[model samples]
Target chain A: MQFGIFSVSDITRDPVSGETPSEAERIDAIVQIAEKAEEVGLDVFAIGEHHNPPFFSSSPTTLLSHIAAKTKKLTVSTATTLITTNDPVRIAEEYAMLQHLAKGRMDLMLGRGNTAPVYPWFGADIRQSLPLALENYNLLHRLWREDVVDWEGKFRTPLQGFTSTPRPLDDLPPFVWHGSIRTPEIAEQAAYYGDGFFANNIFWPKEHYMRLIKFYRQRYAHYGHGTEKQAIVGLGGQAYIAKRSQDALNEFRPYFNEAPVYGHGPRMEDFMEQTPLSVGSPQEVIDKTLTFREHFGDYQRQMFLMDHAGLPLKTVLNQLDLLGEEVVPVLRKEIEARQDPETAKPPTHAKRLKDKYGDGPARQPKPNANRGDNVTGGSPYQDSE
Target chain B: MGQNFQLVVVSAGTSDPSSTRLLADRVAGRVTTLAGKKAQTVGTSVVELRELASEIANALVSNHIGPKLQKAIATLQRADAIVASTPVYKAGASGLFTSFFQILDNDLLIAKPVVLAATAGTARHALVVDDQMRGLFAYLRTVVVPTSLFASTEDWQDNGLNKRIDRAALELVALMTSGFEKSVRDESWGSYQHEYGSAGGTELSIDLDSDLMKLAAGGSAGQKSAG
Candidate 1:
């Protein structure tokens, strides 16, 4: 039952007053939102990476590293760590360094970014993004998990031998959740590795997200991970909460309607009806969110998109206070009642390390190794003839 | 502590097979074994700055040789104990290695121990171990081992050079397990502080390099803000 909020970081005109925050203000607002999330007992604070206008978070590591210094327990992460465009080697080393700085309270949701021009800007062809994502991630996985890799791949120059460093703190790499709104290939990739599948359940309906989550759950089992129900799942939601349902909707609709991302597209009311946006009271949000289990099952992480839609920082913090005080407690209790401990496990650093390295001390060599001095035999990295 | 450690083998040469990383591995491997620990080794093979004439136009303008080299900087920061092996280019260390250090947060290496080793064709540049590296380590405030191995390429494959590796390994294990005890701790009972109310030497920048470290060192000059 991990719960938190994410920001797409758009600076939009305050529709009523015609005021808008500068890019600096929006960035500061994001930091403030993350701190407030921790103050209210949230588990994670994920910031989306977009190398486009209106969005200020071009360098996620710099921001997340700053956030890492501010908070202690909250898992700082990227809402979308562009798996397609950015070099996986940089992603591996930067995130690994952040993981150390945060003391293992870091994870990332990988996505082939939402922007198109960013691909060429970073010297990547958008048409080859799928293959790029697959290949780069394959190298990234080895970089984090293995020490030395002699790799020759399509995306990058040949590495005779290379290792991405700071080696994760406590020898545990941060857990990864492959996030996708429409791509079933991303869902399959997540399931194939038994990693978490995060449906940006904000834009789409429950039926579409349900199918993806269900597919992931089935294929997760197909990969010999566990039962379909035991598959790790997370969902995204857009929410705005206040003391009363009408007041919350009234304050939020202007921001939603005027947002640069979805502003000109759909009416706020129609968007709410069609998607997971809950612009209402804290109690209504809790009730609506509790019903998510009916469609997506007992998921692990739940993130709200409250800071987006150009809402002021003060209003966002107020919404968080209401949700933290009224909403999360009820959801936590209700979810716990329905959860089976064996199946309803949250994906944690400990769980991930155990699943990958088995139930042994972090330092111990692989189970096959008998000699303590031999570094070559037990390694799954290099093949021994 | 789990006692499980990984080895980072940094080499500056572009030769066929890197002897610098190999020698670094030998030292790191033996020490890790002695500590009853498992190790994963990483090698960083560098492209010398002098050979970048084709890419110099881009490098001069941007000061970054693409993302691959950028990732190299990140890798160095993550290592627990680093073994820095470089070829003695000209009369000093390679210009590429020196330039790389300029990009790093120099203060981050405050108390981290590093085993320095160098390789060259001729033995004339041996003073780099003392003149350049030791001076750089002093500025960075890293604990430089008194024993540093320097070898000409002729004796690079010799067994006697490995004895220095064994000794460095043992000393590193001792240092790692026992931790560095500063001289200030040993002479804490000086007369002026006991007789009169002298404040003594107190500054925040004396300790480690992180923001929190600076705060801890800053004494009352530091302010902790609420999130």
Candidate 2:
């Protein structure tokens, strides 16, 4: 299983310190945090994209590229890139460019973006978001593979023989994960394309994810992707660990009690008891996380939400130490021992390229110096003709 | 679908022996007797909101439905009829009562027969049941009886309160006997709005042939004129 941490990139006031870090500091801190994630032996470091205030990651590829450049072994990805508002052409271009820059050490998750105003501001409709997501993803799926694409969709202007440049690193599309908490249609989309389905199982109970994950797996097999066991799955979790359980709870209480998403909503203990949140010692966290597999079955990836809700950089780094040092190792060993061999591993750049080309060289599309015409085969490129 | 029907009472009264519970029980009792007279059996179950106040609040704020709240939801989902009574506070239904209903899935109570009752200290808030609470049940799409039961201290001593209880009970029994909920649920359920996993997580039906489903499978959206 792949272990990682994902952040919503909210820059909030520290409840205990009574001070909010500036965007610059938070930006710098996220880079440091991503570096620490790699240092602490974690595999992936993903960040959310938000076009609103108190959120700094409006440009996920830029931030992720910087992090990818700074780290060697870690995979950088998006918690969710807006599939509704963002033009698929731009997503295809920008993320492919990021793929090339990062040496194929990246993937992306697509979401409809629940924030309502973001739709109209980006010339899209919230009412049309689900269909928009489906249509955009369809175009996006073609863009990465079909070099010369003639495409027309409702949300965007039609394209005639348009090729998204910076052809995917090793000519393989960065693996896509359809992230959804509730929508079964998104799960079906993920299954239909044999893409990964990531359940943001943070706020809601496990039963909600269990239902959707089952559907995704069933549909995955129905679509001839793989067996139900082979369908890729990912789950989101929250953890605050210390050497002692009480200290972990006490330290995390203020942050939990003041968080924008959950503060004043439910007591931290109740949330931990009912949801996937584990605020305790490493052993306690490990025990609680183990139940996830029992409920959702053996899945591919587990991403803990570690860096948001106004946690100081130092505390976050320290939390990573416990996670990387104490928590993840035990989880890895135990989960591996119990996992079904038929379950697919989470997608990575190297594995995907290998899957495409067994032992041979991967595709390297060489363009024909912007000939500005698709007359020479579908693609106006050296490789196509 | 059976001769024996389940009647679930959801009482948001806080006291040891609350008048809200008393009012709902009066309605339930009459419904049981009335059903018996019609050669049917009614089993009553109570969901004391006083016991689930924290759970409902937690669910509202945190979206985590507690075990007790889950059980209550399951009980209500199985209910053929419901007697939902609340104590009026500050000229409105109690927050516990409102929050509990607000947290329930919109489709859970669709077409279910219900009797609305309220016990307030003053008769000034008699409109709390008809004026405020009825709108809530309407939103849930529940078939609430036309008679709204309001029990003030004075009304408890008056025979008029018993008359209202009998009317609401008789209305609920008639709706249940007619099997209106069964027909709407069986025949026209899809016409009602529902989230994918709403209705206490039992609404698991997925239409793979839906227009959205086709779009999810790489079909065009705006080009084809979306539903």
Candidate 3:
């Protein structure tokens, strides 16, 4: 399993400290946190993309590329890159560019953004968001795999002979994960494409995602990708830990009471019991997280949301330390021992590269020099006709 | 058909034996007696919404369904008929009552029989049951009886309240015994608005032929919108 931490990039006020960090301060803190994650031996660091106030991450590629530059082994990715509002053409070009920059230390998860008003801001309709997401992702899929693409879709203008530049770092697109809270169509999309389906298992009850995941696995097999066991799956979780369970509860109580997503609604104990949220010692968190594989079957990735809800940077770093030191290693072993052998390996660029080409040279797209335009070319590169 | 017809009473009254529950109990009692006259037995269960107050609040806010709330939902799911009564507060039905209904799955009560009842301190909020609660049950696609029972402080000792309760109970018995909910489930369930895991978690089948599923399969969305 790939153990990682994902941040929603909320600039929240620390309830105890009574201070909200500035955007710049939060940005700096995220970088330090990512570096600390690598130092502590976590496998991945992902950030969420939000365009509205109190959220700092609008451009995920820029931030991820910087993190990728800073850390060697720790994979940098997005909790979700918006598929609804963002133009698929831009997503294709920019993420492929990030793939090349990071030397394939990056991948992305796609979500129809939760904010509704963001649709109108980008000249899209919220009512048609589902179809928009489906259509846009269809176009994005083609843009990544096909070099010379002739595409027309409902959401964007027609493209004749368009080539997304940088060509995806060794002729392989980054592995994609479709993250959804309650949309089965998104799961079907992921299954149809043989991509990963990530359930943001933080806010809602497990039953909510259980049905969707089961449907995804069935559809994946129906689509001839593999058996249900081989389909890639990931889950999102939240945790706050201390040596003693009481301290963990006492310290997180104030933040839990006022969280932006689900605070002021349910007691911390109730939320933890119903949802996948685990708050307590390392053993407690581990026990709760292990139940995920049993509920959804063997999965590839497990990501925790630890930095949001106005948590201080120092606290986030310390939590990462406990996670890296006391939690993830044990989880890695436990999951590996318990997982079915047919379970697909957690996705990475090198593994994908090896899968694409074995003991053979990967594609290097050196363009045929300076064709006047893409319109009159048989192929963009010398490798194809 | 296998056993006594299941009737559930959902009371959102604050007190243990508040007037709202009293009104619901009276209706349920009459329904039991009426069913017995037809040579059929009735099994009744109570779900006092006050007991699920925090669970309702939690479900409303965080989408977290507690253990007690899940058991209540299971009861309502298996109910052949329901008597839903609420206490009126500030010219509206109690928040506890409305909040509980708001969190239920849209298709959970489809075609089920229900008798709507309300209790208040005055006659001014009498319309709250018919005007407000009826709209909610209608939106859920339930078959609510015609006679809405509203018992204020003065109506308790009056003979007129008993007449309405009897009339409402008869309507409920007719709807329930007619096999309406079963026919809807067996024949026309697909016509209603539902999704996977709806209807108290019994609706788990996905329609793969849907327009959205076609879109998910790389089919363009234009044909769907255009049609």
Q: Worst lDDT window (10 residues) for model 3 chain A? A: A369-378
lDDT of 3 at A362: 96
What lDDT tens digits, residue by residue, belong to model 1 across residues A100-139?
7877778998988756788899888887776677667777
Query: Per-residue alpha-carbon lDDT of model 3 for B1-227, expressed as tens digits?
Result: 43489999999999977889999999999999999998889999999999999989878877778889999999999999999999999999899999999999999999999999999999999899888999999999999999999999999989999999999999999999999999998999989888667888888777788898999998987732232
- On lDDT, the leading prediction is 2
Chain A TM-score values, per prediction: 0.91, 0.98, 0.98
Pairs of residues clashing in candidate 1: A166-B78, B204-B217, B204-B218
For candidate 3, give the lDDT of residue A140: 93
For each candidate in the order shown, give its overall lDDT on alpha carbons. Answer: 0.69, 0.92, 0.91
lDDT of 2 by residue, A67-131 (tens): 99999999999999999999999999999999999998899999999889988999988998898
What residue runs in model 2 are displaced by over 4 Å at the alpha carbon? A372-378, B222-227
Which residue pairs come into collision in candidate 3?
Answer: none
Q: Which stretches of candidate 1 lie over 4 Å from their true place?
A: A353-360, A364-385, B1-227
lDDT of 2 at A144: 94
